[model samples]
Target chain A: MILTVTLNAALDITYHVPRLQPHTTHRVGEVVERPGGKGLNVARVLAALGHDTVATGLVGGRTGEALRAHLAAAAPGVVDALVPVGGETRRTIAVVDGESGDATMFNEPGPTVSAQEWAHFQDAYRELLIDAHVVALCGSLPPGLPVGSYAELVRTARSAGVHVLLDTSGEPLRRGIAARPDVIKPNAEELARLTGLTEPLRAAHEARRRGAYAVVASNGPQGLLAVTDEGTWRAAPPARFEGNPTGAGDAAVAGLLSALVEGLPWPERLARAAALSAATVLAPAAGEFDGAAYERLLPQIDTLP
Target chain B: MILTVTLNAALDITYHVPRLQPHTTHRVGEVVERPGGKGLNVARVLAALGHDTVATGLVGGRTGEALRAHLAAAAPGVVDALVPVGGETRRTIAVVDGESGDATMFNEPGPTVSAQEWAHFQDAYRELLIDAHVVALCGSLPPGLPVGSYAELVRTARSAGVHVLLDTSGEPLRRGIAARPDVIKPNAEELARLTGLTEPLRAAHEARRRGAYAVVASNGPQGLLAVTDEGTWRAAPPARFEGNPTGAGDAAVAGLLSALVEGLPWPERLARAAALSAATVLAPAAGEFDGAAYERLLPQIDTLP
Candidate 1:
């Protein structure tokens, strides 16, 4: 079983408008709502790929209850989530202009979690990790949570003899790396922020040297770069494609975790990650990967040193 | 008892951002969610003004559930809403820039009410009008509802010996007025659309001539004009105020209904409406009126023949 954690989950709402004008009223043509957050997205893709996954997060209020109900109805047996009490779940509204393919996002700062909520989440995480083969701590920390919250979870998972993956940014990533998780996935900008290196290759190397066992740097359409103890490798898509780019990084993380849990070689894992990300971009909706596209792109992905 | 009917109810979401730029992501500084629709807004104000009001509407899905829960928590014993089986409630997002006092609104097309949903809502409306002194049919009709939806509701309320106030636009307003509603409130644009007269006095007269007992036309900061069988009067605020004006129109309707339920004369009702509207414009949040400001402005509002 693979475990994923999202401390600040959101109910993502996408609204399609002809155009967005500031200080004016717009009639939205369409609206789509879904359960969202980095960890939830990763866990969804993993479940779709036939992996056993349990998603644990701090959820609250009516929005949290709705999110849980939606996940239960949509994913059923695959998604197991633990909800906490208190502030309502956060929301992310994406105002998409379909004609222009431009999206404006409004993200809410989710509820503040109390110390008791953190302890409750920790207990649930420990219980989830007991039967987990690999654990991924993902997304931003909610307000009132300590900066090293992810680091504490990583240490707990490591002590339980489980491989841990840390995917976050800024201070959380900075503090979490000290716990030496087995894998850390950071995009190009986040990698630059962590290592203070503008160059991708140098940044990947720097990140690995800073206590991460293996550093995976996702460079958008360019593909994935992995710096592992075995060696460094770069994977690229066979071809460039045009489509929605949101959630491609999370798909790559899901692919990497799926292969790693199955004991695949590092090179194979990189190829799978690149292929999965390419497929995700090809999918019409955000955070959804086309399985057929993934299957076709897998053999075509090129891994090089 | 005052009964308010919302054909299209929405979960109103307000996000505070420093500035709004098209096609960019913004981290909202603050967020507020409330049960909203024109009738719901009127009902809330009436409840706050110490009136016994019930809000009936077509609510569904998780958003509908959230709307009901929010109303229950915020203003318990104020709303008696009916939940439909299909289609989630719509949402309206207002991006507010506090510095400029400007808001960009994105309104979703509410759920398509099936025939069954309409029937269910009509039954709920009949039950709510049992002890109601006035019934307000507010906002636009949802999809799949006929254009004469408001007219049917007005006729039903009249048959039950309840005075109906019709507040809407286009075909719904045209058809609703033909049923001889007690009152019709239209903004400058809607009045122009209904009467094809750019002049406010001419539009109000034309609306009153078209079977409505009283026609109230709200002309923004200039205040209100009313044409009734008794006489014609224009009510103006003492001064222009600056604030969020999203729900001022609804507040005006609330004041008009409140005055009418208390058996005030037509000129006094128009004065109260104008004063309440000005007070709403002075309030910081939408759908809220400053009680002190309203009281102070009440005596200052002047009506001229």
Candidate 2:
């Protein structure tokens, strides 16, 4: 079973307006809500692709209940093992401009997790890992949790003989890589921030040397660059899909984890990651992909060594 | 007992950010939520001033539940007679720029009340009016309700021998005034929209001639201009208070109702309304007043003949 953890899950709300203007009143025409978090996004994509996935995170208050309800209704295939906390789960609002398709985001600070809650989550995670083959620690740590949260989770998964993928940024990612997760997927900007290298291949190699067994760096529209012990490869889709790119990276993570669990080669894994990500950009909402596009783009991906 | 009705109530959420720039994301530093709708605001202020006030309106779903929980905690003095509906309650967000103290508003269209729900509310309204000395019908008509909703409520209150105050704008106010409510409060803009007259005294007189026995026109920082059957008076605070004016009008409504219930003359009522309104502006959040300021400004109000 594949396990994904989102320490700071959110109830994502999208408000559609004719046009967005700052410091002016807007009467939203439509409102769309979904359960959101990096781990939840990846888990949904994996489950949709016929993989057995479990999602665990800390949720609390009425907002948490609403997020759980939305998850159950939206992704029935994924098992939920979320722990409850004291504070209300935060909400993230994306005001989408109907004309330009641009999004203005407002993120509420998520709930502060208590010591007991954090301890409880660690125990719950350990239990989930007992039956898990691979685990993905995703997103930022909510307030009150130590900055080394992802690092600790990486070590736990490694000790349990489960493959772990660390996908985060800044201090958490920096500290997490030191714990030597099996894989780390950072976009070009995150790669630069982590290794201070502008070139993708150089940065991916630096990240791998730091701790990860393999490093896959996303180069936005250009696609995926992978540096592994076996070999180095660059994978790109035949054509770039233009739409919302909100959850495209999460799709890449899901593809990588799914391919790894299936024991695919590094080149094949990159192809899968690039294709799934390109397909996700064509989707209207985040955490969703166009299945037909994914299937069509799979073989059209160019994988070069 | 004073009964206040908010047909289209809201969970008002305020987000404080350092600055508001168009097309850019904002990380809100503080989030303050309140149970809002003009009538509810009036009820809260009235209760705060030791008046027996009952708050009634439509609320539904999880957002409504949150609003109710907040109301129960914030205004324990006000009795809750709010009726439940099938649709989720709407939320209004005010993103306040800390730099300029300006607010950008986004209003979600509230739940549409079905015919059955409207009927249930009317029955509940009639029952509540039995023990009420005065009633205030406030705010907009949510979708799926007749535009003459306030008009119908005005007639119902009149039939129950309850003094009714209409405080709304646009077509509802136009239609509601013809029902001959005892009093009507219209802000400068709302007055112009209703009577198409920019002058406060002329517009107030025009509104009174249509159906209202009295008309109280709020002239922004200038204070209150009242036209009634007995006479006309203009009331102003000793000094203008500069602060948030979000709920100043609702505080004015509360003051007017409290004085009317006590059988105070028109001049005394205007003084109470103006002072309370001014004090509300000095408070940080809406539906609240600076008690010390309210007390200090009350006797200092100048009522002109």
Candidate 3:
């Protein structure tokens, strides 16, 4: 089983407006809602790709109930092990303008996890890890949890003999990498922030040297660059797909994990990650990839050493 | 007892952001949620002013549950007679810019109400009206409900010998006015839309001639103008108070209804309404009046024939 943890899960709502004007009233059309957070997004894609996935996190209040209900109805394949907490789960709204096709996002700071809840989550994480082959610690820590929350999870996964993938930014990411997780997936900007290098190859190398076993840097339309102990490779799609790029990184993480579990070579794993990431851009909704696009793009992806 | 009907109730969410920019992500600060609709706002104000207020309307799903929970916790003074339905209630978000102090609003189109649910609501409305002295039909009709929903409610209240106040806009307001409710409150724009007269006094008179027993026009900053069978009056505050005008009209409606229940004369009713409306503007949150300001401004309000 593949386990994914989202410390701060959200009920993602998308409001479609004809045109967005600042400080004016808008009658929104088509309100679309889904369960969201980086780990959950990755778990969703993995489930869609025919992998056994379990999701764990802290959720509370009515908003938390709503998120759980959505997950049960929409992603039945992914198992729910989310624990209850005190505060209401926060909501993230994307106001998508129909005219300009631009989305203005407003993210509410998530519910604060109590000290008791954090201790309880650590116990639950260990229990879930008992049956898992791989685990992905994803997204930011909700307030009240220590900044080393992801680092703690990484250590737990390592002790359980599970290959953990750390996907987060800022202090959590900085601290988590020191635990020497199997893989760290950071986009180009995040890579620059961590390693202070503009070039992707050098940045990934620097990140690995800082204790990440492998570094997978997503370069938006350009695709994935990987620096692993086995080898270094660059994977690029034949064409750039134009659509919403909201959950492309999560798709890449799912692809990399799936390929790793299948015991594929480094080149094949990089190719799969690049194809899934690009296909996700073509898909209309977040956390979903176009299967047909993925199939076509996969065979044509150029992986160079 | 005063009964307020919110046919389309909402979970009003306010997000405070440092600044609002088009197509950019905002980390929102201070998320505030309240149960809202025009009638609900009036009911809250009436309860705050020590009146026995009952709020009735359609609510459903998880969002409805959240709204009810909030109403229970916050407005314990107001009685809850909200009827349950199958569809989820909607949410309206106000993104307030901290820098400019301007709010950008986004309203979700409420859940589609089945005909069976509409029939159930009418039954509930009639049952509640039996012990009520006054009923205020407020706000827009949700999808799948008849356009003349308010008209039906007006007739039901009138048949129960209950004084009815119609507070809505466009076609619902037009159809509701024909039911000959005891009072109809319209802002300057709503009055113009109803009577095709730009002038407030003329529009108020025209609206009364159409079917309302009395017409109260809320003129922003300038205050209240009333055209009734017994008399015509204009009520204005000593000075214009600057703040949010979101629920000013609802405060005016609450003041008028409270005064009517007390058997106050038309001039006194207009004065109370104007003072409450101005105080509401000075209050930080919607549907709340600054008590100190209301008391100071009430004695200074100038009412002229």
- What are the candidates' individual DockQ scores? 0.85, 0.76, 0.92
Name the runs in model 3 displaced over 4 angstroms: none
| Model 1 Cα lDDT, one tens digit per residue, B1-305 | 99888889999989999888889999998888999999988988899889999888788888898888888876675866665759878888899887786889999998988898788878877888888999999999888899999999999999999999999999999999999999999999999998899998888888888889888889899988888888888999988888767789999999999999999998899999898899898987777899999999999999998
Model 2: lDDT to the true structure: 0.92
Looking at candidate 1, what is the lDDT of residue B164?
92
Model 2 TM-score, 2 decimals: 0.98
Summarize candidate 1's per-residue lDDT along A82-103 as a digit string, tens digits: 6676998998999998678899
Window of ten residues with lowest summed lDDT in model 2 chain A:
A279-288
Query: Which residue pairs overlap in candidate 1's backbone?
Result: none
* Candidate 1 Cα misplacement greater than 4 A, ranges: B76-85
Measure candidate 1: CA RMSD. Answer: 1.6
lDDT of 2 by residue, A189-305 (tens): 999999999998989989988999999899889999989899999999998677778899999999998998999999999999999999999876665899999999999999999
Off by over 4 Å in 2: none
The true-versus-predicted C-alpha distance at residue B5 of model 2, in Å, is 0.6
TM-score of chain A of each: 0.98, 0.98, 0.98
